[model samples]
Target: MKIALLSYSTKPRGGVVHTLALAEALAAAGEDVTVWTLGRGGDSGFFRPVDPAVRQEIVPFPDVRGEAVGPRILRSIDTLRAAFDPAGYDVVHAQDCISANAVSRCVRTVHHVDHFTTPELIACHERAIREPFAHVCVSAAVADELRQGWGIRADVIPNGVDSQRFELAAQDVPGLSRWRSRLGRYVLSVGGIEPRKGTLDLLEAFALLRKSEPEMRLVIAGGETLFDYRDYRTRFDARAAELGVEPVVLGPVHHDELPTLVAAASVFAFPSNKEGFGLAAMEALAAGVPVVTRDLPVLREVFGTVARFATEPAGFAAQLRAACADPGSRQAAGRDLAAGYSWDRAAARHVVLYRGLLG
Candidate 1:
């Protein structure tokens, strides 16, 4: 079967990571899979190397300075729509709002629903949810959201983790030494300083956390996005200064070094207000690291047994303290939990869905 999996950017955002991994897994399962994406920032390929079996279509997406977010979103839709042809593929799956809007017919994986205020964005978000031929969500909670909010039924397919890679990184003495030497005993968070990420909350939590354990540091990594959040970033910087906490902001860590970075952390923080599935937390789990995430239904569904959930900054601070002091049994349990969510399993389920739709 010929399959085309579409996503908005080649950056290492959660959805793009899902897109590439799913494409490779589908190809591994003997399906002809092609990954179509807008190569934002003049990039020509994915953040990391993909298997050669799967075809790639990276449409050039150059940046326009001072372009407003609304106009940029519209242009993204227009550019991708003009370049993408949906004739040959048996299944066309859009992995994000932009890609979903670009295609008229598709199975959209609504990773997470956003409450947009802008007119164009609000319309785009609405159409992306309403117009898809079918829908898939990574968790039952998100699926329930689709049913309740949009009256749409969506299939639930959980994301898969690269468990072996992360697990092995935990054992790499030299690599762990490198990260440990650079950033000693840190609480690591991926997904940059954005409002939804609750980075300010994390900063507050880290500040409170530091009161007790002054030796441990707060480190944030991996922030690649199509949207501009300069205002949020400005707020984050000001707040960090106000809190008097210096967080090591290592933007966009390399794919090769990520596993080791995840493993070397004293704790992994995921204080997001919204999430479909916490893939980064899952990867940290795969690395045998303890996770502390915001208490949300979707997070509870995915990480209930494997992680520590917190309500607010104080809760997060407390949980971080506990996780670092005694990570407890969550380490072993987390790795096992992550190991269960295999990309092969996710791919097989996707294949079944595609076959059912095609038949």
Candidate 2:
């Protein structure tokens, strides 16, 4: 079968990651697959190299200085719609709201539902959910949300991890030594300082944690997004100052270096207010790092006993302390759980769904 998997950007966000991985897995299964995306900021390729068997179509998108978020989103949809041609594909799958809006008739994977107050975003989110010929969700909790909100039924397919890559990083003595030398023992969090990521909550928790573990540092990495979060970022900075804590913010770490970084973390923090599937937390598990995440139904479903869960800043601080005190048992359990999710299995299920749709 010939298929097109569409996403909004070539960045390292969760949905983009899913698109690339699923495309490679489909190609490995002897199906012809192509990934279509807007190359925002002149990005000619993805954050990491893709397999040669999978084709890529990157549409050039220049930056519009001083443009608002709503306008940028509308322009993104228009730019992708103008460049994409759907005539030669057997199935077209959109991985985010922008791609779903760009394409005519396609299948959409609702990774998570967002609550928006802006007029453009509200309309865009609604159309993307209601107009797709079929829907897919990465977790049953998210699928159930769609069913409750729009009366739409969706197939639930869990995300697959590149477990071996991280597993190998855990054993890289030189790499671990290098990071440990530079950062000392630290708590690591990916996904930047955004509101939805609960960055302020994590900052507060880190301050509380320092009372017990004075030498521990907070390291944040990998934050690239289309939306404007300047206001939220300003508030985050102010809060950090008031709490007298400084965090090392590494924006967009190299793809090759990520595994080593994750593996070297004393613990991984995933305090997001909202999530579809906790992919970053799962990667930390693959690296055999103990994980402490927000207590949500979706995360509880995904991590179960493999991770430590907490609700607020105080709770997060307590959980992080406990996990650091003893991580051996959870680390082993997390590795086992991470190894069970495979890209090959996810691809096989997707192929079945596509065939059923065609029939």
Candidate 3:
């Protein structure tokens, strides 16, 4: 079967990560697969190298200064739509709003539902959900939302973690030692400083967390997005200064180093207001790191008893403290949970969906 998986950007966002991993897994299962994406900011390929078996088609998208989020989103849709041709592939699947809008008829993976006030984004989100021939969601909670809001029934296929890679990184004494030496004991969060990520809330929690654990630092890494968050970033900077907490903002850490960084962390903090599958937390779990995430139904559905949960900054701080205080038991459970999700299993399920559709 010929399959084309689409994503909006070449960045390390969750959807893009899913696209690449699923493509490779499908290829490994003896299916022909290709990944299509927009190469924003001169990115010629994905943040990390993908397997050679799966082909990549990166449409060059040059940077446009002063482009607002609305216009940028529209342009992203246009650029990918203009470049992509769905006729050659037997199955075309879009992994994000932009890619779903780009193609006329295809399968869509609704990783999560976003409530957008902006006109363009609202329309794009609506069309992406309503027009797809079929839908897949990373978690059942998201699928339930789709059913409640749009009366759409979607198959639930959970995300897959690269468990061995992270588990190996946890065991890599030299790599872990190097990161520990550089960053000290720290709470780490990926996905950049954005409102949706609850960056300010995390700053507040980190500040409170520091009252007791002064030796531990706060480290944030991996932030690449099409939308501009300058205002949120400005507020974050001001709040960090006000709180007198200096967080190590390592923007876009090298992909090769991510596993080690996750492994070396004292705990992984996922304070996002919204999430589809909590992939980063799962990766941290694979590294045997304790995870503390915002208490949300989706998170509870995905993580179950594998992680600590909180609803606010104070609660987040308390959970972080607890995770740091005694991580051994949670670490074992987290590792087991993370190891249970397999990319091969996810791919096999997808292939079944595709064949069912084709029939």
Among all candidates shown, the one with the greatest lDDT: 2
Candidate 3 per-residue lDDT, tens place, 1-359, comes to: 99999999988888989999999999999999999999998989889989999999999999998888999999999999999999989999999999999999999999988988899999999999999989999999999999999999999999999999999999999999999999999999999999889889999999999999999999999888877889999999998999999999999988889999999999999999989999999999999999999999999999999899998899999999999999887888888899999999999999999999999
Candidate 2 TM-score versus the reference: 0.99
RMSD in Å for all candidates = 0.8, 0.6, 0.8
lDDT of each: 0.94, 0.95, 0.94
User: Rank by lDDT, descending?
Assistant: 2, 3, 1
Can you write out model 1's per-residue Cα lDDT over 1-359, one digit (the tens) per residue?
Answer: 99999999988899999999999999999999999999888999999999999999999999998999999999999999999999999999999999999999999999998998999999999999999999999999999999999899999999999999999999999999999999999999999988889999999999999999999999999888777889999988999899888889999999999999999999999999989999999999999899999999999999877899998899999999999999756888998899999999999999999999999
Number of clashes found in candidate 1: 0
Each model's TM-score?
Answer: 0.99, 0.99, 0.99
Error of 2 at 338 (Å): 0.4
Q: Where's the lowest-lDDT run of ten residues in candidate 2?
A: 323-332
